[model samples]
Target chain A: MDRLRQHIEQITPLTNEEFEYVKTFFSLKKVRKNQYLVHEGDEVKYEYLVLSGIYKVFYVDEQGKESIVQFAQENWWMSDYYAFFKQKNAGMFIECMEAGEVLCSTLEAREKLSADLHKMEHFFRVKLTNGYVALQQRVKLLLSSTPQQRYEAFSHLYPDLIQRIPKKFIAEYLGVSRETLSRLYSASK
Target chain B: MDRLRQHIEQITPLTNEEFEYVKTFFSLKKVRKNQYLVHEGDEVKYEYLVLSGIYKVFYVDEQGKESIVQFAQENWWMSDYYAFFKQKNAGMFIECMEAGEVLCSTLEAREKLSADLHKMEHFFRVKLTNGYVALQQRVKLLLSSTPQQRYEAFSHLYPDLIQRIPKKFIAEYLGVSRETLSRLYSASK
Candidate 1:
C-alpha cells in the first residue's frame, strides 16, 4: 500500500523492487468496531500496522478490571508484544475501536525482511527505539505523576487523541477518576 | 570488552575483526558508589552497558519523592533512555548503587555501528525488543496489579535482584509503600 511505502520511507528509502518484495509480507484485513483482532489465550501470530482508525491493546486482570496498555491509531503498530516476540499465547487483547483496516505481518516475515535488507533493519530499529522511549515515559508518569500532571502530559503528547477517544477511556489511561478528569478537562478548556 | 563481545554474540555472532571494530566505539568507565552517571537537567550523552555492580535509574519529583525507574546490573544496559535517544536534557538520574565498570557508547557511535554492520543492527534491535516488552509488562503491572502481585512478578522476573537491591528502592520501583513492601517481603519468604 502507498501508506506502507510512506511509513517505511519515513525512516529509510526503499527501492521500487524492494518495496514490491516488502509488500508481499503484509496482508490487509478490514476490522469492524468492537471486533477483536487478538484475544487472551490465543497465540499472537501477527503484529499489525494500522492503515486507518483506532484500536486499544489491553488486558483484563484476575479481578476483572481492564487496563489499557496502549492505543494504536493510523500508522501505529499494535500487538501483545511480549507474547508476540516470544511466540506465546496472548496475555492481552487488541480490540478494534473503530472500523478500519490494518496490514498484518508475522514475526518470521519481520525477521526475514530485516535480514534481507539493511535499510529495513535500520527502519525497524529506529521505530523500536522510539517505542521504547515512549513506554519509558509512560512508566515514569504512571509511577510518580499526579492526576493533574498525568492529564496534562497526556494532553500535551496526544492533543489529537483527546477529542477522538472517549473521556472514560482517557480517564482510565490517566489512572484518574472520572470526576477528576472532568475537572481537569474543564480547567484545560 | 570481552563481556561486550559476549553480550552481542548472545544475539548475533561477529567475526573477531568485527568485534574489534565494535569495541572501539565503546569506552570503559569505572564508577564509584553514589556517583551519578546522569543528573536531572543535564544533557544525556551516553548509554552504559553494565559490566559489574548495581545502578538505579530514577527521578525526584517536585514533592521530593524519589521513584526508581529501573535497576541495572551486570550485562544490563541503562540510561535516561528517553533523554539519551532524543538528545535532550535528562529528567531522571542514574546513580551508581555499587562501584562498577560500564561501557559507555554515544548515540552517534550506536548509529554508526549499526550502519556499518548488519549483525550489530540486528543485535541492537533484539535488545530493544526485549527492553520494550519488559517496559510494557511494567506498565501493565503498575496500572492494574496489587502490591502482592507486583512483588511476585518482580521476584519471578529478577530473583537475584530481590536480595541485591535494598528493600527501600524495591518499594519505590514497584510503586509500593515501604510497609507494603515489607509485608510482601516477609510473605514471600
Candidate 2:
C-alpha cells in the first residue's frame, strides 16, 4: 500500500522493486468498531500497522481491572509485543475503537524483510529507536509525575488524542480518578 | 573488547575483522562509585555498555524527588537514550553505584557502525527489541500491579539485583513506600 511505502520511506527510501517485494509481506484487513483484532489467550500471529481509525491494546488483570498498554492510530504499529516476540499466546487484547483498516505482517515476514534488505533493517531499527525513547518517557512519567503533571503532559503530547479518546480511558491512562481528571479538564479549559 | 565482541555475537556472528572494526568505535572508561556519567542539562554524548559494576539511570523532579529509570549491570547498556538519540542535553543522570568499566560509543559511531555492517545493524536492532519489551512490561506493572506484585515481579526477574541494590532504591523504583517494601521483603523471606 502507498501508506506502507510512505511509512517505511519516512526512515529509508525503497526502490519500486524493493517496495513491491516488501508489500507482499503484508495483507490488509478491514476492522469494525468494537471488534477485537487480538484477544487474550489466543495466539498473537500478526502485528498491525494502522491505515485508518484508532485501536487500543490492553489487558485485564486477575481482579478484572483493565489497563491500557497503548493506543494505535494511523501510521502506528500495535501488538502484544512481548507475546508477539516470544511466539507465545497473547497476554493482551487489541480492540477497535473506530472502523479502520490495518496492514498485518508476521514476525517471520518482518525478520525475513530485515534480513533480505539492509534498508529495511535500518528502517526497523530507527522506528524501534523512536518507540524505545517514547516508552522510556512514559515510564518516567508514570513513576514520578503527579496526576496534574500527567494530565498536562498527556494533553501537551497528544492534544488530538484528548479530543478523540473518551475521558474515562484518558483518566485510566493517566492513573487518575475521573473526578481528578474532570477537575484538570475544567482547569485546562 | 572481547566482551563487546561476545555480546554482539550473542545475536549475530561477526568475522574477526568485522569485530575488530566494530570495537574501534568504542572507548573504554573506568568509573568510580558516585561518579555521574550524565547530569541533567549536559549534552549526552555517549551510551555506555557496562562491563562490570552497577549504575543507576535516574532523574530529579522540581521538588527534588529522585526517580530511578533503570539499573545497569554487566552487559547492560545505559544512557539518557532520548537525549542520546536526539543529540540534545540530558534530562536525566547516570550515576555509578559501584566502580566498574564501561565501553562508551557516540551516536555517530553507532550510526556509522550500523550503516557499515549489516550484522552490526541486526545486533543493535535485537538489543533494542529486548530493551523495548522490558520497558513495556515495566509500564504495564507501573500502571496496574500492586506493590506486592511489583516486588514479586522484580525479585523473580532480577534476584541478583534484589541483593545488590539498596532496599530504599528498590522501593523508589517500585513506587512503594519504604515501610511497604520492607513488609514485602520480610514476607518474601
Candidate 3:
C-alpha cells in the first residue's frame, strides 16, 4: 500500500486522507508464477498494477500461436485493455512470469477516482502518454526494423527485462527466430 | 474554433470562459495535398487534430523504404507522438494525402491546458485511453495476423479509410506485398 502511495505520489501527491480514499478502490492480490490473471473469453473486470515480478499480455490466434502484445513489471499496468474499456470478454491473456503482487482496480473505480480527483486524472493521463509513446515505437520497430535492429532496440529499451525474461520470449517479442536471436546475442557479446 | 470547442466538449463539457481560454493555446493550419507537416530530424513541436482531409504518418529506414504508420482523417489526431511527448526531433513524417485543416498545439500548450482546466485534463485522458487501446490492437495485428487476416481486419476497423487510402499505402501499412494486397482485395470480392 505504501508502494502504491509512492507510485501515485511520484506523479501527483495526495494527502493521507485522499490516499486512504483512493486505496479503498484497490485490492492487493498475490500472483504466483504461471498464474493467468486474464484468460481469453473471460470478463476483463480488473486492470492490475504490478507491484513485483513479471507478466506477459498476449494474444493466441486460431492456429494456436502466441503473440506477445506487451509485458508488465513492477509499477506497470496490464489488462486486456480493449476488452476492459469496452466491457467485453478478454481477447488477450495476462499471465504471470514470476511470483509477485499486484494492485487491482475496476474500470469503474478508475473513472470514479478520476471524477473525484483531478490529480488522479492528470496522473493517469501522464501515464497513458508515456504508454502511447512506447506503443508507437513498438509499431515503428515492427514496421521498419530488421531482426538485428529489433533485437538491439529491444535490449536497449528493456535492458533490465532482457536479463529477467526468458530468451525464448524475448525472441518471440522481437518477432525474430530463436536462431537469429542467438546469433544477435553471441555477436553482441 | 467551434470545432475545437466541440471536440473538447464531446468528452468533457467546458464553460464559455474555459473554452475561450483553451482556444488561445491552439492555432489552426490549412494543409495542402503532399504537404509535409513533420519530417524526420526536424524539431517535433506540435500535435495536430484533423478537421478535414487525410494524412499519412510514416517512417523511413536506412534503406529509404517507407513504412506507413497511420492515416489520419477528420477528427483524428496525428504526430510523431514519441518525439512530441519527449520534446525531441521527429523520427517520423506526417504528410498530407488530401487537403485539410488541422488544429495544432505544442507540448507546452497541452500541459498548460491540462493544468488550467480539470475538464481538459479528463478529456485528454479519455482520448489517450482510446489511443492506447488502438495502438494495442495495432501491435496485435502486426505480431499475429496473417496478410489476409490483416487486410480483413484493417478493412473492418477502418472501412472509410479503405475507400480513401491508396492500395499501395494500405499494403505498406499492413506489411503486405502489393501483389498480396491485390490478391486479398480480389479474393474478398
Candidate with top DockQ is: 1
The docking category that best describes candidate 3 is high
The collision pairs in model 2 are none
Candidate 2 lDDT tens digits, A1-189: 999999999889999999999999999999999999999999999999999988998888899988888988999999999999989999999999989999999999989999999999999899899999999999999999999999999999999899999998888787778899999999998
- Consecutive 10-residue window with the lowest summed lDDT within model 2 chain B: B14-23
Tell me how far the alpha carbon of residue A38 in candidate 2 is from the true structure, in angstroms, after superposition: 0.8
Candidate 2 iRMSD in angstroms? 0.6
Question: Clashing pairs in model 1?
Answer: none
Q: How many pairs of residues collide in each model?
A: 0, 0, 0
Point out the worst 10-residue segment of candidate 2 chain A by lDDT: A168-177
Give TM per candidate: 0.98, 0.99, 0.98
TM-score of chain A of each: 0.97, 0.98, 0.98
TM-score: which is higher, 1 or 2?
Answer: 2
lDDT score, candidate 2, position A43: 96
Higher lDDT: candidate 2 or 3?
2
Q: Across residues A17-118, which tens digit of lDDT does each residue of candidate 1 receive? A: 999999999999999999999999999999999999899998999989888899899999999999999999999999999889999999999999999999
Among these predictions, the greatest TM-score belongs to: 2
Supply the DockQ value of model 1.
Answer: 0.89
Query: Whole-model lDDT for model 1 versus the true structure?
Result: 0.94
Tens digits of per-residue lDDT for model 3, B124-169: 9999999999999999989978899999999998999999999999
